[model samples]
Target: MKKTIYLIIIVMIILSWNIAYGEDLNLSGESYVLIDAETGRVLYERNAHKKMPMASTTKIMTALVALENGKLDDKIAAKGECIGVEGSSIYLREGEVLSLKDMLYGLMLRSGNDSSVAIANYIGGSLEGFVSLMNKKAQSIGAINTNFANPHGLHDDSHYSTAYDLALITKEAFSYEEFGNIVKSKSYTADREENNYFYNKNKTLWEYNGGDGVKTGYTMRSGRCLVSSATRNGMHLIAVSLNASNWFNDNYKLLDYGFNNYNRQFVYDSNQFIKKIYVLNGNKEYLNLVTENSLFYPFKEGERENIKLSIDVPDTIEAPIEKGDKIGYIYTYLDGKLIHEGSLIAKSTIKRINKFESIINKFKFK
Candidate 1:
């Protein structure tokens, strides 16, 4: 019995060590990253900041900018510049008109280069203006290392985005319900004269459980690039692979690793009561404090118990407190590193006691 117990103890120690260190995924991508879609926390990354050309994935941003700037029902005519564009296309004809929604379906599901140009021209007034919007959106969303030279992901030396930046862009894009609906669609039929049918090229949606959106890209210079997203047990993860030899399989491993290792846990809810604070000389003796925003974070195995929450507030606050007034802050940390923070605000108004009331209270106490 003693020998068996010793062996079990050794095995348990090994298993605990393995869980702490994590497994090495030896992915076939030159640059790859897996991130929590909700928290934007990176679960795994390998050379993720290295910039590389992304082929048709450029349409992701194109679709996003179009959705933000244009109405889905607006009719946009294909420009002369979109005709006969090289690479994948929806075979757009000059002067052909399609609704912004239909054009987006073609752009994402079919990887339509011409569709990108059409959306760009109609929404931005010119291809150059549209590309500028793409770059600006990228930068605005913290994709600092990314640059967009065109609406379509053509091979341009100036057009490049890193895996990390691509994941950031994907996270931002997924915030739109319309964009998510469009990319996850496997088939779409546009209401046009001809060649209106499209089938999504992303194979992960069919093979992987809970697989959804994103885009795929390929060019001789860029190799095969893929951005994939999956949701399991309320955890949405986004994975990006650049210059990957096995783009689909690489994402599978990346996403599988993320799901297997991390679990999304709700930390706080918006307007959640933190604690009551004593209010001196106020109509109310105490005021409730509530959080400003909700927080959810991914936790690794055994890591939940280690999380620490610190609330910073005064011991007693003076009266005249207004609802929603900033009073304090609540910070959440894991392993001594801050993970999330939110403002603690007054939950209700607390008017100061009138002079007469104060005098009466003093007299009653005496």
Candidate 2:
């Protein structure tokens, strides 16, 4: 009995260790998440759902809101109310005229609070109105654990975001090439005029290889928060660290883990032939259905063959089909679980076959 009890305790200890650190390698932060930008899959996470003060990372959402709602080339006049908001600044003075694009550069790369307020005022008519827009956008993007009290990420209790939510928001932000370009720029010179030059403050663009420009933030109340993105070998990843003891180390470690462990594989390429379906009474005897967009998945080296492709197309299609019409779907599976799903669209239009033509073909073939 004593021997059996000892053996049971040893087994329990091993099981507990495996349960705690089975899939993940190492993680150190109050909250952290590593997500594949292509699929939005949470590769690694710790305390991701816990809401915490998000410091300057909040500006990512600010930049996104401004980019979508405001025009880039439109000139924005610095209102007297936006002059001295506080925190990080682009050193804007009253009556300063700058393009919306330049301000966004400052807002994202420099983490300027004044730029946030100015954008909020310009796009939403007031900071309050802009906060409303921000909340709405957050909800639309499925950022449920996020709230916006200010355009700038000050240490208000009301202004907080979870690591998972930050990853989700940044993933959406990356979809806009304009936004992605601005954030990824290591160093850019923004001209307020012929004389004034504003430089980006994000040092990661210069410090790290393949480092894209992203916002960094710190406050006594918020501790240290950083949202960083990097692209390697055609795979993009977003890493969020909230209240981290060492922001640079944590960000680098998490980003490296994602890049090293995972690779973006084309599960389904656009216009690639997925399946062929017979057409009944149509001009074309058969129709080729293909994927509309390239489906991507994060996979390790030996896991390629384990990925299964299941094409769920209709066996027979009807006539009068327009080109590019969605007919069915392709689902990708890993270990019998669906990982990615894409639509199968008609490759070419199929007009109805004339009754005489159908009869003649059937008789001739017979």
Q: Best by lDDT, which number?
A: 1
Give lDDT tens digits, candidate 1, residues 176-281.
9999999889898899879988999999789989999889999999999999999999999999999999899999998999998898888889999999988778
Model 2 clash tally? 0
TM-score for predicted model 2 compared with the true structure: 0.90
Q: On residues 163-265, what C-alpha lDDT tens digit does candidate 2 reach at each position?
A: 9999999998888889888987765678755424556666666766677857788888888888888888988888888888777678778888888889888
| After superposition, candidate 1 runs with Cα above 4 Å error | 1-23, 278-282, 312-327, 350-366
Poorest lDDT segment (10 consecutive residues) of candidate 2: 18-27
The pairs that clash in candidate 2 are: none
Positional deviation of residue 311's Cα in model 2 after best superposition, in angstroms: 3.1
